[model samples]
Target: MFKKISWKWYVGAIIFTVSLALIFPLVGLKSYVNEVAIISESLMIVFSYKLMIKRLSGPVTFFLGLLVGLFWGVALFSLVGVIYNIN
Candidate 1:
């Protein structure tokens, strides 16, 4: 089953998930909005992890993508906090 999966699908999912993480902060400045985004990012992390588990090859690459997503999520939340502090 894992061999049947395409690399494009993995890449696309990662790209889309990370994009949302980066965009969420720019969409709103409210605390609730940020909380929602953080929740979504956490979900994305799980989603990506499941996908990685599905693949039989190159688990390291998929794990790295998961880490990147996690990092971006945390960084974006921090940025949102900074922006809120500035206002």
Candidate 2:
């Protein structure tokens, strides 16, 4: 099912989802940010796994991608929360 889709699409979708997760809390959806972040992160992990399974990415690439996503998402959320006093 994922073979026909270009890898670029996966990357784009993951970026979009993470962006949305970060944006929502700042836009007055603080209460729902947890849900959003969880879903977004899960989606990103799944996409990374798919890329690895397809041989479009290496195991190291997949691991680093998850690490990067985790740190980026948490850091952004913390910075935004601190700056905006959202939580």
Candidate 3:
């Protein structure tokens, strides 16, 4: 699955994985498998946000876009975690 994925998807996944590890650092849940799972989930959010962005057709679009941005932030963090091996 990683073979055909986009750079952004990979990036976003890693960010989230690291965030979770840092938050629960004492537990030290960092692992390759853990990172992969987090990355996978984060990518889904990013893709969802991308689809939602198209629905931005009016005043609420701005607000919705903002919300999507926040979602992207989260996905980015997960991607970071994967990159740093923080799971």
Candidate 4:
């Protein structure tokens, strides 16, 4: 189902999500930054799951996608925390 989605769409989504992660701090909502990261990461994982399910047609692939999403989520969360601290 997601086969028609272009790479640009994925890039744009990532940019939008990251921008949101950064914006919370800029607007003095620093406390909510972690929440935003978690929410965004969850969304990413969901998307990854759906995409993998549609393309790979197997439970194992779904698990792999979940793992990848988790890894990315943690990395993104750490990155946002670091940037927030740096500022």
lDDT of each: 0.59, 0.68, 0.54, 0.73
Q: What is candidate 4's lDDT per residue for 46-71, written digit by digit as tens?
A: 66766677568678776877787788
Off by over 4 Å in 4: 1-14
Give the per-residue lDDT of model 1 (tens digit) for 6-75: 6566566656654554555566635455555566566555555656665645677567657856786777
- C-alpha RMSD for every candidate: 5.7, 3.7, 9.5, 3.4
How many clashes (backbone N, Cα, C below 3 Å) per candidate?
0, 0, 17, 0
**RMSD versus native structure for model 3:** 9.5
Summing lDDT over every window of 10 consecutive residues in candidate 1, give the lowest-scoring window.
29-38
Candidate with top lDDT is 4
lDDT of 1: 0.59
Give the lowest summed-lDDT range of ten residues in model 2.
Answer: 48-57
TM-score per model over all chains: 0.41, 0.56, 0.32, 0.69
Q: How well does candidate 1 score on lDDT at residue 8?
A: 66
Q: Candidate 3: misplaced stretches above 4 Å?
A: 1-57
Candidate numbers, best TM-score first, in rank order: 4, 2, 1, 3
lDDT (Cα, 0-100) at 70 in candidate 3: 60
Candidate 2 residue 71 C-alpha distance from true site, Å: 6.3
